[model samples]
Target: MKIGLFGGSFNPVHNGHIKIAEFAYKTLGLDKIYFIPTAISPFKKKNQVAADNDRINMLNLALENFNYNSEVSLFEIKRGGVSYTFETIRYFKKKFPNDELFFIMGSDLLPKFHKWEYVEEMTQSCQFVVYKRSKNINKINAKKYGIKIMNNPIFDESSTKVRQGQLALVDVKVNNYIGNNFLYAKEIIHSLLTAKRAKHCVAAAEFAVLLAKSIKYDAKKAYYAGLFHDICKELDENESRAFISQFVENAYDRKLFPNYKLHQLAGALWFKHIYMNDDEEIYNAIKIHTSLALELSTLDKILYIADKICDGRAFAGVQKLRQLALENFDECFKQVVQRNIDYNLAKNITFSDEQNEINNKWSK
Candidate 1:
């Protein structure tokens, strides 16, 4: 019997893992494939993975619809220590002495394969089948290590990106699993904001979705951008200023605004660092939520308008602005910008360079 042993931290297996497994199964003619989830990877940082059971369950959920022969093994998880590939391979070799064993991995790991424990013994025990991970130059020579490269499709999906709320890239089951478990809920957004502010965030998310759908933007992205837009609204002024000073450009200009008004930029940096969210649309929307820009994308405008018209807001003329937002976003945004400028002028509030630039360009 021919068997393929695929192992990883699998932190939470995404579609990329599934694609690689299928490619290995077909190209290598393996009789069965075993997915070995590690309790602790020697190569990865300690406590970086999800709980062992949670990782296993997610792997099970991901493989439920798999057509090829596959099974998940908890041998490493049961071992209760740092998982070494050589130990697992030795155990499998003893069990399947007469069977041929192949180790499957991505090409990116090829460079580090030499650093693994007992590489010579493991290579003698089984052949390695590697698939491409990316177009980056391979630092290690595969021929020197006797590794076979398999022709497989490139998978750009990442588990880290999925955990950051890029749900569209993963399988529906995976998305549902994350949502049901509240795995990626932005805790900072909930913890930092008061109950009233949290309620406002929820309302803003709903309105963002409405505006996004009307304008053909991604509703989910809009929702998250809105939800986290006020994350730093209640943070200590010193902390907010510190974060803005470090991550946000034009920090000195931003300091001109009142602390309450600086949360938009602070919140954007906070989400980027905490959630590992690099989506420009979401980041820009959060950054400019309190201060509408002269030029805005559909998502930017949606979040700006949603923050003002969310049901939790009780300002005068909010109802009319809400109606106008759904009817014509450009017109509604112009009104919002003008209203803010008028209010600021009345209070003699100084504007930042970016704010003044927008007002000068659009306040006609």
Candidate 2:
């Protein structure tokens, strides 16, 4: 029997991982493939990786989606220590001594391959196969170790990116699992904000998801933007300005806005710098959510309206706006902007020409 060993953090097991496993299984004509999820990677930080059960569950969900001849092995997770490639190869070698063993890895790890624990022993125990992970040049030659480099297309998936709120990169089931379990960065919203504000954030996120589904936009982006839109709202003036000055470029004008409005700018930057999220749409939506930007995207409008009429906020006409948001997005968006303008006018609050223009464009 021919068996393949595909191992990685599999942090959330995105579609890219599944594709690589499928390619290796077919290309090597393996009778079966075992996906080993590491409890602790020697290279990655301990806190950065997801819990073992969560990773295992996501892998199972992703593999089940493909219905391929693959199984997830808990050898590394059960071992309960820093997972080294040599140790895994030794364990598998004992388990499948009579069968041919092939170790599968990504090209990104090629540079540090020789530095791994017992590298010579692992190479001698099993054949090594590498798939393209990116368009980077390898520092070391694969032929030096007799490694078989597959001409597979590069997969742009990264668990780091996925953890930073790029849910679209993962499989549908895996994405759902992450969402349902509140895995990854979703739970961090509470730690960064006050209780009342954190609850409001979750409420806004839920409402944003509804609005996103109504408009057929990406719900994940909308939810994240809404949840973290007020991440910097409670920060003192000094700290807010410090973060803005350091992380937010082109903020000469934003710093002059009232304390109430600074969170939008600060929150966007905090989400990027602290959470390491790089989705421009989510960043823009969170940045302008408090003061709606001109020429709004559907996602932008959804977040604005959701933040205003979420269930946590209590005010006249909120229920009507909420109903309209799910029923007629454009009408609801226009009304929400108009109300914001009216509220500011009643409170004797002066808004900029940009805010006025946004009102005029949408109110018409």
Highest lDDT model number = 2
- Which pairs clash in model 1? none
Model 2 lDDT-worst window of ten: 248-257
TM-score of each: 0.54, 0.57
Q: What is the C-alpha lDDT of each candidate?
A: 0.80, 0.82
Q: How well is each residue in 182-264 modelled by candidate 2, as lDDT tens digits?
A: 57755456665678998999999999999999989988888888888887888887777777888755444644565666888
Off by over 4 Å in 1: 137-141, 186-364
What is every candidate's alpha-carbon RMSD to the true fold? 13.4, 11.9
State the lDDT at 310 in candidate 1: 82
Quote model 2's TM-score.
0.57
Q: Give lDDT tens digits, candidate 1, residues 81-188.
A: 888889999989998999999999878788878887799898888998888888763746577678888877788887766655566665667666654453555543
Error of 1 at 77 (Å): 0.7
Q: List the residue pairs that clash in candidate 2.
A: none
